[model samples]
Target chain A: MKQVLPKADTERAIDSVFAAARGRMPGAGLVPQIRARAFEVYERTGLPHRGMEDWKYTDLRALIGEVLPLAPRPNAEALVRAKVSAEQVSADQAVKLVLVDGVFAPELSDLGRLENEVVVRSLREVLENSATEAIAGLVLSTTNDSAISLNAAMATDGLVITVADGNAVKRPIQIVHVATGLSVSTFTRSYLQLGKGAHAAIVESFVPAEGASGYQANDAIIALVGDEASLSHIRVAADASDAVNISSAIIAVGARAKLDLFSMTCSGSISRYQGFITLAGEGTKLSANGVNLIRDKLRADTTIVVDHAGPHCTSREKFRAVVDDCGRSVFQGRIVVRPAARKTDATLTTRALLLSDQAEADNKPELKILADDVTCGHGATSGALDDTLVFYLRARGLSEKDAQMLLIKAFFGESIEEITSEKLRDFVTAQAEHWLQAGR
Target chain B: MALLEIRDLRVGVEDREVIRGLDLNVNAGEVHAIMGPNGSGKSTLSHVIAGKPGYEITGGQILFRGENLLRMEPNERAAKGVFLAFQYPIEIPGVTTMNFLRAALNAQRKARDQQEFSTPEFLKRVRDVADSLNIPQDMLKRGVNVGFSGGEKKRNEILQMALFEPSLCILDEIDSGLDIDALRIVASGINALRSPKRAMIVITHYRRLLDHIEPEIVHVMSKGRVMKSGGKELALELEACGYAQFEDAA
Candidate 1:
């Protein structure tokens, strides 16, 4: 017996991604079997285009010109050494979760049981031995994006972190995924499971090894917050000059659960980072923030889709982007409120600062609410820095460069200061200050 | 004997001269008021003295403490005992008043070979200053000049002056938007900082502020230069009738 999946836009988007992949190689037997199955599902629906309300500004077609291969794993050792921030992890320290050629590197992982309330290990271990069905049932390899779909097909190892019920972990677990070695397109995945009433914080940092770039790294992550559970998650992307990252995050919040997610994207050649959040249970709350500081010709496209599925859920999102040179920043955020999800309160705001005349900011905020009792709104604004502010700081004894640095810092402060850890806060602040001081 | 001496000063903005051949000298601890009509180059003199950008020094020599101020950067001039209380303070969003002030004070302190104050110590000192001025404790926590009332801006100027404590303070239109009570408090704040080693230049269009600040000498500026110099009584006389004489001269 087979189950029938609903004919939703999400399903169509997934189908289109498969079609894009299936046409790349006409294979025989097993290759076509897998490709056909994926393509059939994709044929029923296509990837969301700009016409779609959720994908109004982000034109995936423009970015998906050619399909990348999912072969040879990334060089884990080289990437780990180059991309890792010396400030964050000591030369020899850090519970590193290396993804060599897109495969999990257990030899580099450092994790231990804390108070017997949480378990941290590689995804391969959980896939082989974890008894809980939630861990297995929660993993979805099929996504609307072809790159994500490829990642789903090729995901062999990832980070598997679980928080037990009624347990609060004070120490922040760091997950560092490096792409190095034989650098063909790498498909990496991260699966995070949270138990009821469990509280924890995690920082997912991604960087490419010395030879990292021009290759695609399609990655997916799932974070399940159980009832009364809390989570503070941050995702940092500091890739090399030629790397392209297409990362996705799917979060399901249980009743009365709280989730705070801060995403910092500073350096990447071309990154299409997407986040999908589902308010699955009532009384769930979330504060999602995004900050990106891009210079040169790098491109960072951030798209977020939040679904208000349950009643009495509150979700707020704030995104700020600072673009300079010829870099382009794109933001497409959508909030969907189902009829059953009444009393849902949500707001999305995207603000971009264009430093140069050539720099461009594309922002699209959408709202689809069938519930009359729901409160959902979104706004987007893009502008250059105020000359008055620059002059004002200059008059206060700051040089033109120093004054611009201060103004940029202030502009990006709303998002950076959202990190709860003072140490981490200072670390990111220092990174931003360095970028400013370098005259970027 | 002179704290700040301007010799044959000529300042211009965008190739247009604003301060032409202006001369002024203020001895230590002296309060000089530069009173003029709206376009008489009052603010230009303050900017020229503080080394603010956009104003080209076509011809002038500004000597402060026996050093050429025109050769110094804005912050350098600020560290060299020169302060300018802006007529309209810029609103710096996300930068708290305390943080900016602390950074400024530390930058000045470093230039002066002094140790920087720790966060707690700095907070204590600021709290004490805020207490003296009856300012709300949380006001310093807010973004600089953001959403502040006009009078509050003037008070914040005084607050910055107190924090920096420069030797020569040039306040441009500090009394513009202040109320009588605020003016009195601001005047007191300035008077409290007055010492034999400090000099102040107060710019105002009305005599009401002079009544509170009590300047020793007055310079009546017409067009781009000082037309006459008189005792403090000139402010009262100008208040009684008007600056008709000066306007006619211009």
Candidate 2:
């Protein structure tokens, strides 16, 4: 006989919230039907738990004890606080698009000099005025995960950006999400599309206002790269000390396209960054890299899945983690080569540095190849700092702590250097250094 | 007072004693060469002085200028004028040689209550020293000892020895993997640092290196003890006759 158990408190609360908020959600025609379907999927699966293989190391059901109510619309005071917080992490020489408490704030964003090259709209406006087919296309999912389903049903507002054919956007587009409320949750979703031969750079930054704590942020981005186009996407997650963050990126690369994606996580009490990328066209190139600097009791995870459905595609994935005190880091990478993906080349490498006996690291790599002519390899390692290297530096007149710091910086250098933009690279490096200083 | 003093020194690793009842004295402005077989503890003495860990001092006392030497950390000992040129220089990736040199120099200087070097001043000093050693500017920009050849690694060690300007320098098998041309270049670099107020201890197994460095005294070691002590001519005699006589004497 099949055993049945009562619904958890958070699950029941989510059910009630969905029932009360469905009629109020902004969307006409197919949008509401899509939302209902997404909600049904969430109900069937419930919250991801330890029993699921994908969420083995990070049990979201257990970690998220209770789901807080949806955050209220930002008031004047909240906008002021968000502005101050967003300025600290805004990338230099980039157009800024600010989202305060999950709702797009046009007054705080600067889309100057980009009016002629691209088209941008808020997700709420698109849902309210755009065609049903366009609305459904914007919310398409590459993977059927429970958390993403939850996001599809609850996300209120985000950006919808598009670049025309052969248009090379000179400056980067930065989307900054600032949290200014306490004990609330925010869900935001965005979509980006590039025409043939188009080039663009996008950056996503998640931060918190001063004195704001205990917030939850669930954000998602969907990107489509056209043939012969190139795109560079960088995400920086520096949330509050007591915040819970879950972000996802669903990307597809077209024929002969190039994609460079990088992410760095230095804060947040519990955070997960997952990516689902597919090579839909032949002769595509992809590079994905990440770094995690976690301390105290904080936890960070980077999970990625790359599907090579086209022929002669090449992909590389590298990730590094530095764990200190009782912190924990998890990395899970999977590569799949379809039967048609002959002559595919893929490699994945992950390394972890444990600074104390209590620090923990978990790494898992999987490969599913249905083609005999493909080449795939993976490597994973987790250990403490090398003692020989430490002694060598100490003998050269550096204190023990300085020697370890230098080595830790070097450990993170490989992944950070892979970022194409020098400005972004230096900014990420400084963030890592700040984390090291705080740990000291 | 002697620059370095060792009185009845006995050292052990695990249960095995490597240095047993060894005594030696080094005075200012003198270069002493200690030659021995593989297991005669010549390297152990240098490591103990430079404060490498994992060695137990069963019974020993070492003094530098009338102060106990074993009571300080490796960095403190280095700041107090002790340097060791390792036989195999370690390769540290992602840290450029120039940056490492600056960090090490500034740290030692700060420990002695000296001001840190400004960027321009440090760069000028490094360029001058590196040019004399035939180290190209490109090599300094590369990772420390990373992808460096055997002779290049040895020359880098000499470059550091010149920059730190320590009072006591210990060279442990520095000539192990150098050709004649490379050996001459490294020897000249080492020769430039000799001073009336400085001392050096050169540990080797062959007499080829001694011909260029020209030590003032020679000590033959066997079975973790000094079998004989004499002038520079002792190195040649041992090279010709081999270590059998010294092993039998011990």
Candidate 3:
């Protein structure tokens, strides 16, 4: 295939976003530095598409082909109110950080009980209010990826959740980064920092606000699990039928740390979620599972990279997808074990269920082990529901629909059961069953 | 009074018929053993009676409690007191035995318009049933039939039958892959479930299971048909003769 330039419409759109990003910068401590660096990278990389290796199966070309940022609408307040209220998990239960249309909605949000051990602040506000040293060392130092830099430059207001050493937030934190009505392009940069011995479970759910369309949401969530800290991040997305949601999460699990990431992509037009986790310390453990349900010619891609960089570290990754009605789902999971990472046990498995003959699921589970003492394996499987099992269920007096629903429920529940929270567990299970009922 | 009446039953899987015009009946409080060689349709009789799919009922009438049992779906039959101890039980991962058993029991109960049981009440009931079958309560917490030994799987099946408490139980080779101790335990469980109102059909290749749970009638099946029917002595005669009479029917 020939390398095609950005579509004329998209180029104009990107240029307009760059001009707006440069013009919209509010002078602050770290803003000027990050914004300058972001613009440098933005000019170099432009917007990555299917041609890039990491974006190979994603084909973001369809999403980026039309460059537009949804303009902030008049009903932004109402949309933000509904977004937080509509969360399946109660706002009272989550350490809620509500971002409305790329800016923190303070009046509509609740950040409760934060002492020295915990800190809940906004990215833009953090930059404006942080001590100069903290702004330079902490805020401006971490983001190395081009996407994060790009997001940092254009992001208006974002979340900054920090935990001091040996502190664990009792309740799971819920960060709802919602893009409300009509945006041409939106950039979001959020960060989660856990110090040593800290633990937290965070759920980041992004649902397109009602009637939001014709836009690109370039999202970057950077999570750092410090030594002896354990964190679980659950990402859920329900994109509008016409909207394109592109998000990436880069997580680094430090020495003896643990990170568990679970993601479910329910409804989307073209969505790409990439997870990059670095098992940085000996005895560190990392596990990631993604369940993607796609329909109506929609395409959802989940790409994960797990690196066992420390000795005695463990990594497990599993991806399951249900594709139907000409929908396309792609899962590319890679587990890497270094030569020094002895006793590193890593496994990757991708199981896909194709509901329609025209629907397709492509899974590539790859393992690259440079250590001889490591135990690593990878497997990819694609199949329909077992006829024998279906017959067995129907024989027991279940209708065809009921039997398939039960089986698909059981099939998807295998991973959902691994979720630690019972409340979230039941909610996701019911959601999965509901999706099955919709036959999507 | 006959609790179960199978008249002119003809069944086939795919295109080939397996149960060829087989007729059998059982009165309340009676236990009947259907013995046959491999492919003799002993299993098919149990599955077909339970309404398993893929098997066409070209000609058959199964009357249970004066109702057309063949017309009922499998779970309906189960709800109406029909249980089949599977020859090969399914392995359901991530689903605990207790969870699935509770669901099955509750499903049956719901069909009967019974109130649902609380978790504690269900556990208490399950414990008693498990203890009687020599099954550990911990087994219920494990995934359904996953990684259980052959004997353990069969015992789990009987445990389910015991818990469900169906009217006319069908044991399809419950003794097939069992050790002596397992076979005795299985037969004892069946014996424990026997009631005057609850009849049973024990399908097997050997008569060893009948030793513990005595059957009132024994029938030798060959080529999808019952060739001989007699008392317990029939098992002894078949054991002595080694199925020489079965070759004539083929």
Q: Is the docking of candidate 3 incorrect, acceptable, medium or high quality?
A: acceptable
What residue runs in model 2 are displaced by over 4 Å at the alpha carbon? A1-6, A113-115, A140-142
**Interface root mean square deviation of every model, in Å?**
2.1, 0.8, 2.6
RMSD of each: 5.5, 2.1, 3.0
Shift in Å, residue A351, candidate 2 = 0.6
Model 2 per-residue lDDT tens digits across residues B1-250: 9999999999999999999999999998999999999999999998999889999999979999888999988888889999999988999988899989998999999999999999999999999999999999999999899999999999999999999998999999999999999999999999999999999999999899998899999999888888899999999899889999988888
Q: Residue B197 of model 3: what lDDT?
A: 84
Could you report the DockQ of all the candidates, in the order they appear?
A: 0.49, 0.74, 0.37
lDDT of 1 by residue, A1-440 (tens): 85543545444443454444443332223433443554544444343355555454555544544445554543444545544432244222224455655666665555442346667666656555652444454554455654455554445567777787888877666676676633345656677778899988777777665555566666889888999999988777877766777788888889999998888778777777888888899999988888887889888888888889999999999899999999888888888998889899999999999999999888888898888877788888989988777765655556667677778899888778877777666656776676666655
- Per-residue accuracy of model 3 over A58-165 as CA lDDT, tens digit each: 655455566665345226465555565446434346666666666676655556544446788777777676637555344443344455556666766667889988
Interface RMSD for candidate number 2? Answer: 0.8
Question: TM-score of predicted model 3?
Answer: 0.92
Candidates 2 and 3, the one with greater DockQ: 2
- State every prediction's TM-score relative to the real structure: 0.87, 0.95, 0.92
RMSD of 3: 3.0
Distance from true location, Cα of A148 in model 1, Å? 3.0
Error of 3 at B15 (Å): 2.3
Cα lDDT tens digits, model 3, B151-194, are 89999988888887788888898887899999888888888888
